[model samples]
Target: MQKITPSLWFNNNAEEAISFYTTIFKNSTVTGQAYYGENSPMPAGTLLTATFQLDGQEFIAINAGPQFPFTEAVSFTVYCENQQEVDHYWDKLLEGGGKESQCGWLKDKFGLSWQIVPTIMPKLLTDKDKQKAGRAMQAMMKMVKLDIATLEKAFNGN
Candidate 1:
């Protein structure tokens, strides 16, 4: 057991959300599920919690009802290798019911927000030349799901 596993609360789709997350990340899958028992908050057949692993990180989802919702204030950042990888995740995550926000941020179908960032973004934005870095940051601020190639082009003053 990990010392701490991030637990998420869902209205009623803990299982489905875990399945969807496992599919999106490599070496990931649902490990176990616990159904709501007698006297539990949810119905007997509904899920109380489900354990899942994504890229070696453990996560748990609980069908805790609609008291809380995911917000832009907190989101997971996926460091993508290239623009193709960024596009792939962006498209897949946005399908069905996701929405886009400015500056590489988006809310998936589950209302979970994520930041699909490029691996090389930090280096570009922290370049020795402050002006170049500033330009890159400015360009990134205008769009959602940052594109590596475009950011690079902006950094290069092109």
Candidate 2:
């Protein structure tokens, strides 16, 4: 068992969120779920919580009230191996009412913030050649969904 798992609080939509997430991530599964009972805040049989794994990372989601809403302060970063991976996640995560944000950040329909980052980002941003790194950084700042090709070109001073 994992030592710790990230827990998510949803506005009576934990099941929907779990379904959405499981479908989006290729390697994902719904491990367990619990439902509310009599005298509970929610109707009996309503989903109370769900435990799931995405790409081997365990997470538990609760069907809490609207008292808590997702904020950009906490975001999930999806490090992609290439531009294709980045584009795939970027498009899928923005499927419904997702909103785009600056510098590879976006908020999905569930209001959860996500960063679709390219794997090469760290190396480019920390290159020994400061000028190249700066150019790459500037190029990334101008993008909503990161483009690895553009970053690589900028890093190479092309």
Candidate 3:
């Protein structure tokens, strides 16, 4: 188990989301699943919770009904090594349905927000030249999903 596991609540798509998540990340799998007990209050076959891991971080997705929905306040940021990795995740996660938000943020079909960021973003953005960082930030603002090459170019004042 991870030191801290982030739990996501879904109206009823917990299992489906787990399947999708497990397919995306490496070294990850569904660890546990709990369905409503026979003598429990809920009906049979109703899922209570599903535990899974993504990049070693354990998470539980619960079928907690419509009480809570995903908001952009919390987002998953995937630090990518290169453009290919970024594109791979963006294309796969955004498959079927997803809305692109400014500066590398996107809402998956499940309304989950994700940020596809390059590995060098922090170093580049925090460089000595504020103007270069500003330019990169501006360039990023125009992109739906962040492009690492473009960001690198902007950071280099090119």
Tell me the alpha-carbon RMSD of every candidate.
1.2, 0.6, 1.4
Pairs of residues clashing in candidate 1 = 103-143, 104-144, 104-145
Better of 2 and 3 by lDDT: 2
TM-score of each: 0.94, 0.98, 0.94
**Candidate 3 RMSD to the real structure:** 1.4
Name the TM-score of candidate 1. 0.94
Q: Per-residue lDDT for 28-101 in model 1, tens only?
A: 97888888778877778888888889888998898888999877776888889988889988887887799999
Give the top-scoring candidate (TM-score).
2
Query: Candidate 3's error at 94, in angstroms?
Result: 0.6
Error of 3 at 105 (Å): 0.4
Task: Per model, state how many residue pairs clash.
Answer: 3, 0, 0
Deviation in Å, model 3, residue 134 alpha carbon: 1.5
lDDT of 3 by residue, 1-158 (tens): 56777889998878888888889888889888899878775677888998888888888899877888999988899999999998988888887798878788888889999999989888877878999888888788889888888888887789
